[model samples]
Target: MNRYTFSTQSGKAYYCNSIPGFIADQSTDIVGRLVRHAFDINKEQANAWENQITELQRRLEECGMEGDIIFEYDIVRLGKRIDVILLIRHMVFSLEFKNGKDIFTTQDAQQAEDYAIDIKNFHKESEDLYVCPILIATDAARYPNPQSCDCYPDKQVHLQRENIETLIPKITKISSLYGDDGEIDFDKWFNSPYYPTPTIIAAAVEAYSSHSLSQIAQSEAGQENINLCEAKIYEIIEYAKIQKKKCICFITGVPGAGKTLVGLDVVAKSLDDANGLSVYLSGNGPLVEVLREALKKSVESNDREREDLWKRAKKSAGKTFDVPKPEKLFNKHTQAAINTLIQSSYAFKKDNASHSNPTPENILIFDEAQRVWNQEKMARKHDDPIMAVSEPKLLFSIMDRHQDWAVMICLVGLGQDIYDGEVGINEWFRCGIEEFKEWELFYSPLIFSQVEDKNIDQEKILSCERCHQIDELHLKTSIRSFRADKQCQFIDALLDNDPKQASEVYQQIASKYPIYITRDYSLAKKWVRAHVRGSQRSGVLACSSAQRLKPEGIYVPTEIDVKNWFLAPSDDLRSSNMLEVVASEFKVQGLEIDWAIVCWDADLRRSKNGADWDHYSFRGTKWNKRNKPEQKRYLVNSYRVLLTRARQGMVLFVPKGVDPEEDPTRDTEYYDGIYKYLVSCGIQEL
Candidate 1:
């Protein structure tokens, strides 16, 4: 049959379980593998490449070409060959094929001429014939590295396939670039694997938005909030509009930047508009409980309206919409279960990636991105469970694909965080970690591709002492935060091991907002109870660590029972999984008080020999997931839930060591940097 057989001469192998019929059979040496190393890649890429081949055929036909479009084809038999064949206006015939490796030589020319003879003999065409051959090498650089698929001294065309796209534009630019290559062979292409003419292809894509983000056309939030705290909500809106990108702006902020408020604003905007889908994608346990209650209120507010729905639906289909009974939809237990399932071992990765139709008008906003949406690398074995082992650089690649279906992508979390080193910097900035790495397109699954920008300033972005303010145009002028925010700011700046950055946090607070050093929990409680009294939602999360809280405790709350509380995990992976049980218990009582009194419990003495236990152990070779042994590490992930909860504001319920009475402010300048910044901004003095 002389079927065109192709195989990787040498490369690494991969395994895929995407196809049921192609499932790997058990019992071989190195049994489970997929794509085995690309080239014939997958159904997706093969068609993508073939489409380019047909485009070239279309070009030939437009200039008056003809003949059999494709040879008798069978993928399993013929492999990746005979991309297309065309008969030109003047007794001229052509054959087109794409090679990952550039093959633009006499040998390649002979192969095409031979294909020409075969076509002629089989079809019994006219005797007068001229054969034209075109060899397309997609990645021109890799194929002939540094040598192009164009300007071949002896032969024709090397339409650049850098994007696997650009094939069309290149198709249009061909006649001019290659002088006398003739016309677009539309007839041949219409009959090739990449069916439908270029016009049809363009129309179809016009249906799907382009996947690109340009700085001049990107979201402005990063530039606006370059100076202050707060969600920089307005900027987010602008960015979404300009790029037309459905995205999740991953945000990592302290207690007061108003990430949630911004999220709410986004949700409200989504609901009111018809073009975008704006959803608060966080279905966390506690949060879902709150959402259910709110949903119930909505149902209560619209009981009569729903009855009308029942009447209308009954009239039409002889049935009711059933509306799922708002109560069932808003059941705390049910919502909690849904939240748990969404973040379960099964749903996290793929669900996050998939933004479904009947998709929201804009984006599905997700906060606490780091905690829940981990970029995990699943080390799956056929015998192993389906979950990925979760490496740090996991989803670093497909973040764009995840954002494409939406209008904007928002991620909020600390960057230098997850210090335990299970991930990579998903955000790229050439200068350092803090700045945003501007990207236009992420072409491959390898994640990022930097288009050469003549103006990427590696120079540091100028900023004031707060390290938050900058030259961004959209500065927020709202003081929606509070007093202890000063203390929190102090801890973040001056309490560092190396005494520097800021000298007086008091001054820092003054420049931004008023700083009140209060040592009364009752008074703090009074303020919280007064403000968040009924729907009064606020907390004074404690830092039992004496590590993060000690400084604030000195001037904040003096009498705290720092012993039997949570010390809070510095970085925890199992938070969402365990907190549900704990939250359900205390949340029922005042233990789940409207205001939380948090502190890093001084009791986590790192496991010596445990008590309430049985889990797994990966001791070198064998699997021992049965009991707590000396080699693993685990902590109550609830520490995050504690710090994150205040729907309003929080207090400094910290330990003494984490802060100080005499002031690391050292008589005056300890937080000088912060105070100076606040002073310049005209914030009241601490």
Candidate 2:
């Protein structure tokens, strides 16, 4: 994909010869080039490009600057583009324009700053350089002093349009303090690979809008693995379609390895195909609600913009445009369309099981397939003894109703089954081997490396002629925490009670990814606030069973609106930025925050000998020990989910309990051991 619409070096000479003398063209000719690069150019976009180009050209001529000027630079990670970027003398200036506006808004400022942060965090060429984010409200009445504005710790400065010329000289004087990196090479910077780690919500919105994987995903970190997996799935799908056979595929990966992203990409591609139809089903209620709401809002905003642009285009052409009284020009943004593409797995099962007809969709993609309910849990949930079938078997029966061909793609995350009766991959294997012997199976090789359970018959499944192992189905890299790719390994070793291994891994990643331990709750919150920059998100997280933490201002029993908590603005009281409310593992399993404050409680603490962990449940007034194996495992996995939810870094808040005699539930011994244990594991103290 083309990175920018137009690029030219400052002064009279240009460096790039590919466009052939376009630098000497007029403003109208430059606007034509920008329009060519745009996928769908409307009147508003074209007019804005013209104005920005004309004004920038005048300013460059006045200042006599010597550097590169780029227009409409694409930031693929956010699915947005910068208005203008000026690279001059070891300084990168990101300019955001608000044409015909009289006032500057907080949202506009955040947008400008976010673009600069995206460059510093993801752009390999700008890692060590100084970045300045300037917001221009062309028609504003008052302009602040250029010297009065301060630079953020991340080296971003927010300024108005009037300060652009004056601020350039001031930044040049201070550029020496940032180290002399000399001039930036335009060719190397332009060709640098952009590896952006987008949030799951952002990825889903981009994918559902019909964007390809290359436009939405990272380029270097495991891009080949994801592509190979996608290709292998398509091959299986084609073979099944041509041979008129039913096939099942299993894709396993480490935590935050883009399993959901791969599934969403395939579903989008299937929708674009003329002959095939696919639906993405998930049992994660929070994930589904957040994604659907985000998509609806995006569609509404685009429709409104398009309508406004259409009216402007007609008026500019000197033609009379009639405004419809009762109807809208675009009505494609409907709830029914969104629901058809993404649906609840439970609702799908109930609807299909109530009827005897076959489904129209031939391809079914299941997210979090390991969390599907077993036979007993399904029966208990419905309060019906006759419902003896597991969810996997029921889904298989529904798909088997198709006469010609069908394909089932299961996205599994190992050791992520935190709830009871949420059968892991074993149930699907058993169903395929015993009940549905005719279905062909394709699986990742990682499935065999998991801890052996009595229910899984590895030998029997491997001996079956239909089962095939493919290495491409496994994603080995964790792209969620782009700062540290080995974060999952560190978390795994820490939770497994291997202090030596955890310490070793922590030493390797400490400089890039910070992990701190603190005894005061306020310190943890302060750390998160200090580390977060621009529009990056930060929130407080705690385990669901952390009842003893109520006195410390953390109440896990109160439910939060996942949509608002994850997507709301900073000033909103219900937003995560407030940090007054906390989300448990259940609310944030499939989501992530930029920075996190994990509130550690006595629900899971280190043993007296500091060799193992102890699990407990607070009932009524006192704490009781958890004895069941599944219950213990659930408590352990809850911390796993909480620890891995932050993309940047996190701080563990281990509060110091009061005297045991005054408060039996809040004993000093309960939390002290865990704090010391974490410190020994190489976590720095706050």
Candidate 3:
């Protein structure tokens, strides 16, 4: 007769006196209910698995198994009843079911062995025939000894628990003597919902998730490929990971506030987890290329080899495959591209709903979100009634579809740079966009002045009415440009002064930073050309609307060469998904210029409004006074764009006596010109 024995660290032999540690973990239900995931399991799954063993026994007998079955029936002599007991050839065959993974351990394996021996001995004196013990576990993924050590080699079998209906096959197989005929038909068992079906466990690895199961992966030389979360980026990572109450965090920053840095850091934090991904997007095409090149360093550095080395990688899995491993190829750009394509590709049929399957790698970030919000106004479809990308409604629709996925969409922009109409038409993104919004102001934080009471509010004067609804956070700190406390004060004071004082301080600031005022278009063009070359630092050529700065030579377009930008208000411009095609006129703003020339000629100066229209124009298209006012408004916007763009120095030109040293206005139009506009906009004249 077969015999079984069970003992612990104490080494005392265990009898059928009491159940072992196995029974302690079981409450009223199996232990798997305790397992949790990043996402929640539906409630319908709960009641379906609730257990009562009698139902299983009845199910087996109904399926034509000629035997009496008992449910949770404890044998008095045996101490504990088996989950399933059958009578065959007058010998008892006991079956124990392990549905929970917790029961699968080395100790549990030993316990199962002991039970088999105990049951065999229990029926050792059976007057009839052979006796055996059957051990069956359902969906026990963690079952130890899939080969050699335990009797079963496959931890997960193709049979999941369902209505008591599944008991028939389970009983028929376990009850029969062990042999080839006893083998399970996995194809048939897989379709049976009466028990847990076979499935590979979701894997956890120390490496990055770049490869797919369809592809094989080779290990890399160094662990550096995966980025470690550190510093300020860690907070953003925590915010994305653990906020139970959902919040759409819209982080607004100026040109260099490190929005991309923070965004990337968030991406780094999520790299190891299955619930996170990183994506970096921007409106600037050249900048995007630069950024892309920069990121390749990290990816390649982590890989520790050149391109040829990666191609030669052999699968460590020992199986040949065609596809790349997700761990090997899953870089920041790859994730970004996947998510962007997923959102951009959809047919919005009326009344239709969509579902998204999100993995940790699903993330969509808009670096130049302001640009994305607008339909391409200049590139509108000829048949479509609405203006192209600049149209707010269409952009809202795009963002809405993505919102349905509960995607963490991050939008970054500066108040001056964004067209407000194109944002937040969807409910999910509505909160905190305007009033609760952050960072409306962009300036040197400690920059205070005694000469001028306050800095000019661009909207109050320049009439930049777009994005009025957006809640803005002003970044008070200046990291890009540095100025001493005294110089900063001096610069602010000089800007508000009369032309003489303004010129004096402008010269002073220029002396330190070097702003050369040149009326010569050739000089300006030459200086700008030199700056455009990618160097250790950059340079810009700023041209105001009053001055028409023309390149010294005839312009020619070539894919291979640097193209010079000519500042002209009428320069045709277009917006594209792959490009930011603005003319030299508008492009010069918000960018650092090396040298700027104020080009004052007929075409640019003609639109210079009768200073009277300046007040009404600053109030938005509130007037029906005609395009005359509009032209003047556009002209002011042109100037604002020009003055703000230059980093080192800029030149100014005014019609004859319209003071290059002070406010430019005819004596009679003086109040209507610079005075009224300045006072309305809160600019204190020094």
The prediction achieving the highest lDDT against the true structure is 2
Model 2: per-residue Cα lDDT over 1-686, one tens digit each: 53332244221111222212223458787788677667767666688777766666665655566666767677877778788777766778787877766676877877888888888888888877788777777777555544434555546554434333443454454454443558787777766667788888878778777645556666357678788888899999999999998999998888888888888888888877766788899998888888887777677767776676676666665545554422442356567777877888978887888786888789999998988899988987765343467989989889989889999999987677788888777788888888987799999767778522336678888898899998999888888888888888999998999878889999998877788998888888888987766678899999999998888988985578989888888889888888977999999988899999999899898888889999999999889999998899889888999999998899999989999998988888988988888877888898
Tens-digit per-residue lDDT, 129-180, candidate 3 = 2334445554443333322211221111112222233334643554443322
Summing lDDT over every window of 10 consecutive residues in candidate 2, give the lowest-scoring window.
Answer: 11-20
Superposition error at 621 for model 3 (Å): 26
Ranking by TM-score: 2, 3, 1
lDDT of 3 at 268: 39
Give Cα distance to truth, residue 273, candidate 3, Å: 6.0
Query: Would you list the C-alpha lDDT of every candidate in the order shown?
Result: 0.32, 0.78, 0.32
Point out where model 3 deviates above 4 Å: 1-240, 250-275, 283-290, 293-364, 368-473, 482-508, 524-534, 537-686
The TM-score values for the models, in the order shown, are 0.34, 0.91, 0.36
TM-score, model 2 to reference:
0.91
lDDT of 1 by residue, 367-460 (tens): 4443332223344311233334342222322333444444333333331121122232232222122322332211111111111112323233
Name the best candidate (by TM-score). 2
lDDT of 2: 0.78
Candidate 2, position 96, lDDT? 81
